[model samples]
Target chain A: MSETAQRGGAIPPNSATPLVSLRDIRLTFGSHQALRGVDLDVMPGECLALLGDNAAGKSTLSKVISGTYIPDSGTITVQGEEVRFTGPNDARSRNIEMVFQDLALCDHIDVVGNLFLGRELNKGPFLDQKAMLARAQEMLEALEIRIPRLTARVEKLSGGQRQAIAIARAASFQPKVLIMDEPTSALAVAEVEAVLSLINRVKAKGVGVVLITHRLQDVFRVCDRAAIMYEGTKVAERMIADTNLEEIVNLITGGH
Target chain B: MANYTERAKQSHAVEWLNDNAQVLSIALFFIACMGFFWALTDTFMTTGNLLNVVRQGAPVLIVAVAMTFVIMTAGIDLAVGSIVALINALAAILMANGFDWVTTSVMMLAAGAVVGLAQGWFISFQGIAAFIVTLAGMSILRGIALYITEGYSIPIKDQAGFFWLGRGTLAGIPVPAILAVLVAIIGFIIMRNTRYGRQVVAVGSNLEAARRVGMPARWIVCSVYMMSGIACAIAGLLIAARLGSGSSNAAVGFEMQVIAAVVLGGTSLMGGRGSILGTALGALTILIIGNGLILMHVSPFLTQIVTGVIILLAVWMNTRLFGAGFKLGKKG
Candidate 1:
């Protein structure tokens, strides 16, 4: 595993100081060691594709980065400063946002409300609907996401639209490190193209993006580096240009 | 030239209809009930009869308004009747001991809030289900009232202003009805325009999502219960003032009545959707049914059966007919 070039990060190795660095992180649930001694780095303006089979700790490791799960033993440093995140809110304050695979959204809440879920715009004691509506328009337009009506409840939208809303919400947070778990898995062909382009747009803005997906072809399209995991440990990290699809597939199945 | 690349816009009228399906259906049901009663009884449509309906329905209406918020968070307060009973008994007890009406009323409201907060703390912070906590509250609070009152009704001799709250009229409208309308209006504005209202709906719709977004999700859940408690206190005071007596058995079956009204008004029992206007109308419909049944010379006990059946039918129609997917507004 150490023989591979840039065996640095299923997180990636870059010249600049990483926006986020995770070292020897471990997490166990009951008897299952979800993540065992994982090291990763998220660099600025780069896209890192986290690759592994079903139980290779991709989600668990991503959760650690997002602060949904606190590791048992490890050090997580942001921009060279070590920190302990208490919860998701802690990670959010440091400009790290995650788009969940299942898309944690309130179906009954409108698109605008979902976009501003926890951070509502209030005028005195009331919801500032007029202000929020205007801001929501700007955010949606900036992302090039087209919803017929901003006031429409999320439940009424199609799957691709809902996914678009989730991505837009996270992207609008001005996050330095954006973690997206299966951003294009449920999307239609056109929607998938939209998401890939959006990833490039976010990367162009100098934001570090970590994408976790089962679609192998996606990494070749938007990822700068690919990190492979085998049984809770990172086995290989490669520049997208340095590795072919066969080698990544072999690495994923552990040379099966 | 149509730009087929861009999504077509929906007319605002359709959107408004989609958002208001529940309220509109409830309004239709309410009007049907009103018309049914008016046809059967000559006195049903009269101004005096209408005033009596609102006046009598005021207590249930006030509690139902708060119950809409509670239900919106997918919570139920089974103890509202017991809280009302306790407050009614306590108000009389306080007044009998030489406390003025204003002081006793203030003390009763505070007690109600304390009781509600305790229950909310258990339900929200301690992770207990709202139904279980409030169910226990129903029994314990009523038991306290019965124990203190010795199963007797306490009488109030004086306090004109307090009695006026229940019986006085301004512009020929019953004071209790006016108070109920004020409560309903305040509830409407809160649910429509306030941040607290939005928080309540979001928490009810999806607690985990609300929490993930960093909203005070648990606190919002707890606060709704407090509002329910305060509403119960207000209802209890009104009852005590109107009857000129406070009894241990006051507001018995009151929780069921309020729940029925909220449900009949298209406030989903499953949570995250509610309407104060629907609730007010729901309360009125039930009150009118009771009054109309008596006027038609039907057996008094049959009114309960009829009201229960009406609630069942109304809620069934609301869900099965105008269900969540039954949007009137069409998007292009």
Candidate 2:
């Protein structure tokens, strides 16, 4: 009876289908295939964790979704319309921003400058410093980032502060779906907590998040659903309540 | 608690000292040189000698300004000396061929810009190292200069304004000095105020990060080399006017002097950090040394060794002062 009800529960509230739906995605780099027939559905406002071991297709999927790579043969539909990304800039223009593993920040630039880098606030030809700073301050306050100086160079910032700024930059763009690849992997324990809070804040703002991480604790704590990829294929998709850490690890490491 | 506060105070003082070390070291060097000159010669401090220093240092200073940008990107342009010779020959050749002075001057400047762009494109876009490309450029440009004039010095006639640039003084300031100062001011403004300037610094610091952020790194690199070429051409024309003769041998070994001035000014050859004011001061320092040596009747042969030693010391001081501020490959 529970199984029947589980299958009949309005298909987990994807009433308008997924904001991003990837079907049978494949990626090959030279002799190695990074991703193979990977299918994913990310509904709006939900945090989905893509968990996998080293060399898994988690990074490739994130890259493809972020428009860094073109899948060899696949159908990616955004809001029920088939979409193909030519590059990262194209993906960003489509309101799909990815927080790369390296964060891709210009350290010499200040927090406000980094936040509004390529897409700066401008009044005609001049950069609108007042408006851009105000917007950056708002994003920081909303995320609860306790930076001592917003004008300080990113190079002088603490690790946590840098991470917060990176997230804020992506968040300020207000993408429909934010893809964060190992956002907290290099962060300390306190930094991790701050990042978790920031992610929740983004999710609350109605932006779907695809968190690609190796840590199981983050997956269970922050994510609604878990998708485990092994080798090049995603082998399992489970609700947070229905799975345990050990089982997920087994699925990632083993074929069955 | 008192110990912690005292330690903190000591560290803060040290940091302050480190930050101001560049200016402080230069001041000390300046004072010491002045004292030595006063002891050795009476004419060294005169206005006439000062004017002489300015006249002699102007061309080198102009070339050094452009060199600062190239060195700031951790790149080198070995073809600069040869390019200067080529420009000198071209200016004279155009004048001899019945071209008007204005058109000939414009043509020479354009030639420099084109040559710079060509070399820059090869280095920045073709994925070739700067040293290799500029090395080849140096030989190629020297060959072109030789081929054009057949190793002969040609006197530039019918171009009085061009001649005046090297020999004329304007309101107590020499023309070349004025030109150098103006170029330095423009360089300072661009590096400090403009977005494109910041991108150049960023690319020098890290190309991968710059590219990821959509900076036109190749363009910036290319533009810098082009500017360097234009500078060399200007300096070449100055040398030609000063001698009233354009030759393939004019401005020979000038690249070394330009690099020396930049390094003395605290502009590291490793790139990502430079200051135009520092470069100007560095050029002045070179002029002072050259003048002081001449007043003391030091042989030109020994002066080269002394200059080399002084440059090394200046770079050592720069490293000691700015070592903590710049991080090398800390990202990876």
Candidate 3:
């Protein structure tokens, strides 16, 4: 791990603390334990790839971080300060934004509407459409995203366009920590490239990123550190340069 | 490098047509209905007959405007007709007991909102399906009206101010029609331009998505029902003022007519898509068909059959013919 740590470019410097640290997080549902005693740390300007096979508790752990699940026992420290989140909103108030696997977009609304969603710009009692449109344009432009029609409803957009909008919405919120679950699962090759570049851009801003995906290639392309989970517990944490794809695959398939 | 095809850019006129296909189809259908009626009967084209149609259609138009919001949220309020009857009966009873029209009207409107809020609570907070909750409301509300009035039509007498609301003309236009128009205009602006309107559409489009985004999804869902209730109250008041009587039987089958108008106006029953302009045109269409059939000496009972068939036909055309890829053959 120490040998490959040097190759993990953009890793947070020693002076910077971990953006989020989790200790002994445990969660259960009826007879099943979704997460059991998981510990993890994410540093600023680093991309952490969460890897596991089906039913490996990867989603459960992400939900715990995103405040969709209340762990039975855990201490979550953000910027070295311990805190508890009651719901997703609480997590959001702390500038932790999650791009859900399903994208969580309103299809009937236009692109600007989806981007703004709950936080609409208002003038008096009405929505400031012009201001919102201008800001939405700026947001996409800043991210190097091209959406021809900002007023077009999201339902009409292609899969890649939809994913881009979802990421842009999360990225534009000034999030200190960004979590994405399988964001490029349904994208074409070029679209996947777009998203990978987007992740790099976000990471460049010193934001901690947690990417949960099944695509190992994506992990190699962007993630600096990889965590592998087995059953309901994390089994291995490896610096991306320290571990080969075979080693990570073995960790996921229980061969290690 | 992946060869990505540039997205096809549609001309502004084509984009506008695509966005408003449902509304345009309904508009064309409305115009066709008007032209057919005018060709059939000279009386149908007369200003007096048109004004009468507006007056008679005013109550349905008011309720239908509110129903557009309810339907846009992918929810239905079947109890609106029952609520109207209840308010109609309650208003007469209040006035008969020496309560002035102003006090009685205010009380009825409040009653309507309370009833709507109660039903909304069950549907939103309690996780009950809107259809089932409002179905129960339909029966219970109408039953309450019948029980209170005992199947009698209570007379409302000698309130000139109140009578003006239903019977008086403003610049030769019926007051009820004017009120309905104002309500429609307000509904149109709110749905098209306001933050609350956008929230309502967001909630309807995807409830879970709206909630995850921090919208007060439950509150938005509940408030639309309250709006429907208020509209029903206004409608009931208009009916009472027009007939000078209130009865449990008032506006029977009104929910069906209102829903038909909304659906015919291109509002989707599945939620997330609706148009207030389409709803107004739809209400006018129904009223015109009924009036024209009568003018052409069609049987009164046959009018119901025709209206029902037209609603079905109009919705069928909306979903099948004019839904998508519909073009006028000539490009702008």
Candidate 4:
């Protein structure tokens, strides 16, 4: 294990506290245990890939962090202070935004509209279309994303373009802890590369990102640390520098 | 630069056509209907007849404007006709009971909003489907209207101002028509320019997306119904004022006309995509068809059949033809 893995990334001289710290989080649904005593810490300026098989509780744990599901018993600490989220809005207010696998874009709305979905800029009672348009262009350009027209409805866009817009929407707001579930699932090779680079940029901005994905190659590209989940419990945590593909794959398959 | 376009994409012109297809198709249909009426009837092209068409169609237009908002959010308000009938009867009864026209109008409008709020509550907050809740509202409200009027048309004895709302002309235009036009303009502004309008489209397009983004999704859904309610009050007041009487039968089969107008204007039944401009054109087209058919000495029952056929045809064009890119001369 690397020094960062041994101390759980807590010994860094400049940044000591994790952005989001979870301890003994457990949740159940009927007869199935979705999560069991999972302890994890998301440090600032780091990307953590959460790896698991199909019923490995990756989504459940991400939802718990995003406030979609309230855990039955757990301690959720943001900035070292214990807190419980009542809903996604509560999590959002604390600057913890999640990009779900579905990329919740309103298909009928225009590109600018989806980018500013929840928080729209308005002048008087009307939507500040000019301001929003200008700002939208800037946000997309900053991320090196290009949509032919900002006013075109999102349904008219391609899947990769749609995925890019969804990420830009969540990433542009400067969230402290950004959680993305399978964001690159719909992307092609070049699009995936763009996303990885974008993740690196977001990490540099001191935003702790929780990436839940099936593509393990993407894990090596963007993730600095990884936590593997088996059944409902987190089997092991590995620092990216000290871990390889085989070790993480074994950890996910319950090999110690 | 990272090109996000991984596959073949549409050109800007094709995309624009796809977005505006419904409105354009409806506009063309409106013009075609007008020309057909003009070529057929000598009297239909006259200003007097046109003004009369607008005047009579005003009440339906008012309700249709609100219906656009309701349907834009992928929700339906089936009880609008009942609301109009209830308000129509209630307005006359209140006037007969020594209430002034202004006060009665205010009270009637409030009642309309309350009815809408109640229905909205059941549909949105209570998680009931909008169709079921409003269907029940339609029955219950019409029943209330029948119960109150007791199968009688209550007359308004002496209210010239109230009478003017329905029967009066403003600058050679009917007051009702003027009011309806104003409401349509306001509805256009709201749906196109306002933040609330964007939210309505957002909620209708993908409700889960809207909620996830922290929008007041339930409140927005509920408020559109409230708008429908307030519009019903206006339409009711106009009818009562015009006829100088109110009864349970004031707006019989009125819902059919208003809904047909909305759907004909290219507002999708599935919600999320609608245009107030399209609705206004739709209301006018329906008005022209009825007026033109009557001028041609056709049976009154034929108007209903024609209107039903038009609705079906228009919706078919909307979903089947316009669902794809609206290429003017290009073939697949």
Highest-scoring model, DockQ: 4
Cα deviation at B115, candidate 1, in Å, is: 1.2
Residue lDDT tens for model 3, B1-332: 32224567778988888788899989999999999999988899999999999998999999999999999899999999999999999999999999999999999999999999999999999989999999999999999999999999999988889989999999999999999999999999999899899988998898889999899999999999999999999999999999998999999999998999999999988888889999999999888998999999999999999999998999998898766445543454
Find the candidate with the highest lDDT and give its number. Answer: 3
- Expressed as tens digits, the lDDT of each residue in B1-332 for candidate 1 is 11113456667887888888888888888788789889998998999988888888899999999999999999999999999999999999899889999999999999989988998999999999999999999999999999999999999879899999888899999999999999999999899788788888889888888888788998999999999999999999999999988999999999999999898888877788778888988888778878888888888789788878888888899998778868664342
Give the true-contact fraction for every prediction, in order: 0.50, 0.14, 0.56, 0.79
> Per-residue alpha-carbon lDDT of model 2 for B74-137, expressed as tens digits?
8989999999999999888888888876787788889999999999999999989999999999
lDDT tens digits, residues A93-198, model 1? 9999999998888888899998988888999988899999999999988877788888888988888888888988999979999999999998778778878888
Query: In terms of DockQ, which candidate is stronger, 1 or 2?
Result: 1
Residues B191-290, candidate 4, lDDT per residue (tens digit)? 9988899999999999999999988999999999999999999999999998899999989888889999999888888889889999999999888988
**Per-prediction DockQ:** 0.46, 0.25, 0.55, 0.62
Tell me how far the alpha carbon of residue B170 in candidate 4 is from the true structure, in angstroms, after superposition.
1.5
lDDT of each: 0.89, 0.80, 0.91, 0.90
- Compute the interface RMSD for each candidate structure: 4.4, 7.8, 2.3, 2.6
- Estimate the TM-score of every prediction: 0.95, 0.88, 0.96, 0.95
lDDT of 2 at B85: 95
lDDT of 3 by residue, A1-256 (tens): 4423322223343677888888778899998988877888888999999999999998898888888898999899999999899999989988899999999998889999999999999999989999999999999988888888999889878888999999999999899999999999999989899899999999999999999999999999999999888888787788899889999999899895
Sort order, DockQ high to low? 4, 3, 1, 2
* Ranked candidates (lDDT, high to low): 3, 4, 1, 2
Model 4, range A1-256, lDDT digits (tens) per residue? 6534432333232356889988788899998899877778888999999899999999999999999999999899999789999999989988898988999999989999999998999899888999999999999998888788889889877777888889899989879999999989888887787788888888998899999999999999889889888888777777889989999888888775
